[model samples]
Target: MSSDFQNVVPDTEHKGLVGLLPAVARPFAVLARFDRPIGWWLLFWPCAWGIALAGGAIDRWDLLLWLLLGAIAMRSAGCVYNDIVDRDLDRQVERTRSRPLASGAVSLKAAWIWLAILCLIGLIVWLQINGVAKLVALGSLALVAAYPFMKRITWWPQAWLGLVFSWGALVGWLAIVPEFHWAMALLYLGSIFWVIGYDTIYALQDREDDALVGIRSSALRLGDNVHFGVLNFYLMALSSWAAAFWMLRPHWLAIVTLAPISLHLLWQVTTLKSADGDDALAKFRSNRFAGLLMFLACLVLGQAG
Candidate 1:
């Protein structure tokens, strides 16, 4: 592989398809972050949680599959769009300086084209759902499109991301039930805090660089108190999720189902090394497992008679 293809940040250690693809195709793969399956997994989990909690997963597994596909495609599309919009800022940040668009390995036109292709795939996934779900899914586009600029304007871009990333919860619930419920709303809200918590962990990797570049983030905003902030966010997430579970099943067991994830979040907070970039990345990636724990909690609660 050429040096250009070798420029991916250290955080995404596994090159996967990017490693196997011809050098000419490597930049596009990086742009879509196919090498980083964690992004898609984080995005997919909220969709899965929504489906399971809404009682759709047992009978409508196909819908869960479609939402997963949508998450991968749309997450890729969002990354491409973010790269395009933040190329200048990315060039200034150490971790992002080597991104395809930032490093000039991929041109603006090509990046946009790749984004379009991903969006087209997302559209195909969107078409698989009902009209109301389609509408709910479409509602996320504005949030997605605005996200690249949030770091430029706010200290809490992660909050905006919380809204964007957790949207699948809403879409997943609506895809099956068609009507809104307070439980779904609570699930969505809790997922938002979960995203905020995890993404703050992710932002810790770029804290110094982002500060130097005048970019705002929760990690930077919390400064020395980042770990405390994360703990608070995680606690809020668990509280909200517990409330949602109780609303759904109204049983002690439903709350107990959340114990595993609560412990997992506790482990993440306790083990986190805030100033260590590699540790931050590992903790951020661990949320994939956190998502699974939540899904099981939702599954158990949703399945109860």
Candidate 2:
């Protein structure tokens, strides 16, 4: 369908409301993904994991709210920045051509203004955390700022994004407990691989266009064996989480509680179809549920311990 039809059709009828938002905002709202909440959820999960793992007698409802806001704001800002940098490449892709910045609906300058506003919101949220968490959050800015350039320079841009997206694990953990814990660090590292595995699947959606435009991605790097590569990454993610769990809880039940999450990742790998881009995207989006399951596992174990 043309952008005209896409915009006129109410997003209430669409499966992906986010794409609709960019289409309707006369394209400006795309800067904030008011249309897409999945990115925020993906961004929010690590923070949730950190918060849950840091469980004590502490109530952090206020901090959680701030993190949620920050997730939405920063995720939107990151998307806007990415669109601006990749506008040319985006226009070449079927799925992304209609994006605000790529489609000429929103200018680069306008998008930058929107990005700045979102960053301010993120900064406010950062201030709400402890000094250590604040520093950790600040450290992520460089990663966020440089992410748009990664695809141009490396075939593993998704790996870089894993680092950027999972930084919240550290920030959220340090917020509740100022001390460093190797177990938490391992968990965060595991989450990073999970992001890389899923995001690589997402990147497959544009692999054709990406290659045509000289954009590098793990999907293209892995080539026909992309499925195997993704499987290996997921296995690594599961192993990392297992190590973290053993370190933190060191109980048979804690390990058993994580079975569901590992099985879910296994299900995704065994059933996934890399030849079909839509299939890859659907599988990738399903990680939101995967993250939730893992978070629940962490919450249950943390409370029990």
Candidate 3:
């Protein structure tokens, strides 16, 4: 990988596919971040978690597939919108300077058209869900629309991202289980902390560039205590998850299901190299698997209870 391509953040997997695209379509593909499946995976996990923990994993397999498609389309749309809004800021940051919009590979008008296309796909997925889930998913639009500007005004934009990205949990829960439960709220809350923790790792890659460009991030905010901050954030995530499990099952054994993910997160914190941008990126990307582990935990508890 060249220095330029490294700017793509989690440039670990399937990146070679982008190189095979034709010049005309390559910019749009990059703009949508289609090469980086990690974003959609992160988005999809919370939705799956919601469905599984809400006791819809088996009969709701169709809904799971539809929601997965929705995550991909909407995550892509959000990236295009963010690029359109933050083209200037993206250019100032070396890590993002090569992005389609910032590099002038894709014009703003074309990006908007592509964003609309992605949203069309998202709309199709949205229509497949129940009215309750539709309304719940729709509520996330305001948070998504405002995300690009968050770094400009707030040091804790990651918290806002938590609210935005973790919203799929709510939608997934409502898809089949519309009844309110404290377990659902606790699951969503724990997911917020999970997002904050992983995104802080992602932010580590841009710390220097962000400082130079006046873009705020939790990684920058925590400074040298980044390790400690993420540790606590993940701890909060596990504790909240444990509490959620208790609410659903009231069994001590349910907490045991969380051990794998808890250990995985501890591994991430224990071995993280804060000064190594690439290491930080690898740690952040590892959450895809962490999300899987969480789904397994949710599956166990959801089915058992």
Candidate 4:
């Protein structure tokens, strides 16, 4: 790999376990993205929001931990699967060209084996949840399986990712309540928009390469108006969340808890440099904090009674 390609593989330089692991294991770690925790954090937050907003997370903290573990494992599995499917495309993209599969650091057979191991871990975590949650979680597999192909088939792959990533909210809620409610649905929808917005930001890093490779992404579709598009998505997300909160608590103050997250998102849009990959990535990674803020809002609102 060229030095330029090496520089662009996200978080490859992070001196985490991927760095400390023996050289043989490093490629697997890279393939699974253990060195880049932002992906799992993004996946875990909606799960936390659902649990916290349903009033069970405070007491059943073990459930939150299980979901977190599931997020890490499943996100890794999803990445491995995506890399396997997109290996050709990955080799063409500047940022992803150095990825384990594309760079031939990990063989396809080994990648498949690693994916199975990650899914096995996810299965253990899934089994710890309630039967309803188990069923709900299982349903996400179809969405997950279809996601890697969305870029080839549609211009709105980020939208499909929103649906897939935000399914965890439903699973988390059903894990505790075992009953469907409008508030949970609204929360899930809100999270879908949230994923769309952040993933759009993430896609900005690849827009040029994506265009050259004929991969469709919201960032490429939006063109120069990407900032405005992100603002609209964030506004929609906040609106859905506000409605969910109002439905759950019906108190004027319950909606106020979202203020911090709303402001944080505002800052992200306002400060975003749409053309700078580093700036785009910084804003994208900052969603981890955004997730924490949203989780805190849910925790407060869920405990309000």
Candidate 5:
């Protein structure tokens, strides 16, 4: 939850269970991003997209639970590792200065330990998945480990994030189907572009800080043309989703039913004010709803079939 971005200073105002908890409990929460659940939601949506779109029936309640838990654990673990690696850079940025690692509330050693704990939880969840899905999930570790360094090396770090964040889409589909399908592959690609679009919007919030810190981001890459770039990415996202849908269900009505989600993405692009960091962040966060809308459309199409 980048909401901490708004309050650079820790809110020492209300000190209760969170503040009074043992020293051990405090850093773990920060490591897990208990203060910010949105990251988990963003991570969870792609899994939902893969599962619901496969039309393989959602009777596997156990698998759904595993995916849900895995999303939370892995997202938290990713954030902890990212913060640990970026602590120096984070200290230079106002929005990130107060982060546990950056602010020295948690030591680097402690952060790594917490990261291990979260990853252990993730591994436990991964073991609950099928062999194919488990292998697919394990394969994402390299991407996740290298993501923090991508901003330093590439102008399009969001594209790298697209790969990291949307890996669950593949795992989700594999958990159900256990075999490759062109339709699911297209849907995974669509989710990647969706992550790139929204994460670009998120990066817009840090453009100034990132520039000063010598960090690269799609927002900096696109600059004044970020809005147009976002439009293009979101448009491509919709097109890929539409292609995925039509490939699975060739009916004209399926494409028609996708209209609402497509219109929503259009609204996101048309009304987006990239110059306003708050507006851009709000729009970025709104993708949770966009994801849900798309999932509902998938549900309808899957059920209708």
Candidate 6:
């Protein structure tokens, strides 16, 4: 791992898609985390949830594609921005020591340039959405800008990340309708809790390293109660989503739409191995499936209901 990142970063997928790129391009890909599809998937699902639950139209499936591209670009830009802000801190953490910036595989100038390029892609996505959705998307920038510093001031940085990530719900809903709806707000709220739960699971991997570096996280805040805490957060998410479904369709059938994802989240918390970093990572990654299930449920509610 000679500052080249050719050997793969610890937390990244081993020899995954990034490896297929050329040598010089590899570092940039890792910088934006192109190797990790999970990041973008998590971001995109919330947008899909907003769209589908807002009454998905067949023609608007194109919007899903645009939103997915937006998710990839924006999530990558956020990762680069976070790495730039956290590069020194990353050096102190074992899991992130080999990150492109931390390892000097990518320079600050290059990283910033890469971030701008990613944002350019996001700008292209902005052209596809309606005016109100664009404004909603803009509102997330402040949250994104401040997110890297959250660990310095609060134990609930994941909550802030929740606010930032779940923002796509607002964008998705607003894209469909010019006005706000209570159901959309609940969907967004549920997504916030969902992010907090999964990201807390993600933070479990960095617990020791984070404490050593004085980085605050929900995992550290909860300590022994991490499992219970995650369970409660998931429950909140499910409850909020159930309420959302009920509001949208006002039927027992709509509530039934959420059963699969609810059971999947249950499996995650119940089977979670809080002591093992690998298990924590697996549980965190499991959110991709959870997001998919949620999307299907929202799709069913919006279209079939």
| TM-scores of all candidate predictions against the true structure | 0.98, 0.91, 0.96, 0.97, 0.92, 0.97
Residue-by-residue lDDT tens digits, candidate 5, 188-294: 89889999999998888888999998999999999889879988998888899889889888988888877887888888888988888878878887888988888
Query: Candidate 4: what lDDT?
Result: 0.91
lDDT of 2 by residue, 114-197 (tens): 888888998888788889989888899899889999988999999999999999888888988888999789888998899999
**Cα lDDT listed for each candidate:** 0.90, 0.81, 0.91, 0.91, 0.82, 0.91
Error of 4 at 283 (Å): 0.2
Global Cα lDDT for candidate 3 = 0.91
Cα RMSD to the true fold for all candidates? 1.0, 3.0, 1.8, 1.8, 3.2, 1.4
Residue lDDT tens for model 4, 1-305: 33433353664547444567787887788788887889999999999999999998789999999999999999999999999999999999888888889989899999999999999999999899999999999999999999999999998999999999999999989998999999999999999999999999999988878889899999989998999999999999999999999998898899899999999999999999998989999999999999999999999988875
lDDT of 1 by residue, 8-108 (tens): 75666566657788878888988888888999999999999989998878999998888889899999999999999999999898888999899898999
Model 6, 67-138: lDDT tens digits are 999999999999999999999999998889888899898999999999999999999999999899988899
Q: Per-residue lDDT for 194-304 in model 3, tens only?
A: 999999999999899999989999999999999999999999999999999999988889999999999999999999999999899899999999999999999998888
Clashing pairs in 3: none
Residue 225 lDDT in candidate 5: 93
In model 2, the Cα lDDT at residue 167 comes to: 91
Root-mean-square deviation of candidate 3: 1.8
Clashing pairs in 6: none
Q: How high is the lDDT of residue 94 in model 4?
A: 81
Candidate 2 TM-score, C-alpha based: 0.91
- Backbone clashes under 3 angstroms, per model: 0, 2, 0, 0, 0, 0
Q: After superposition, how far is residue 137 of candidate 2 from its true place, in Å?
A: 0.3
Report the Cα lDDT for candidate 5: 0.82
> Which regions in candidate 3 have their CA more than 4 angstroms from the true location?
1-12
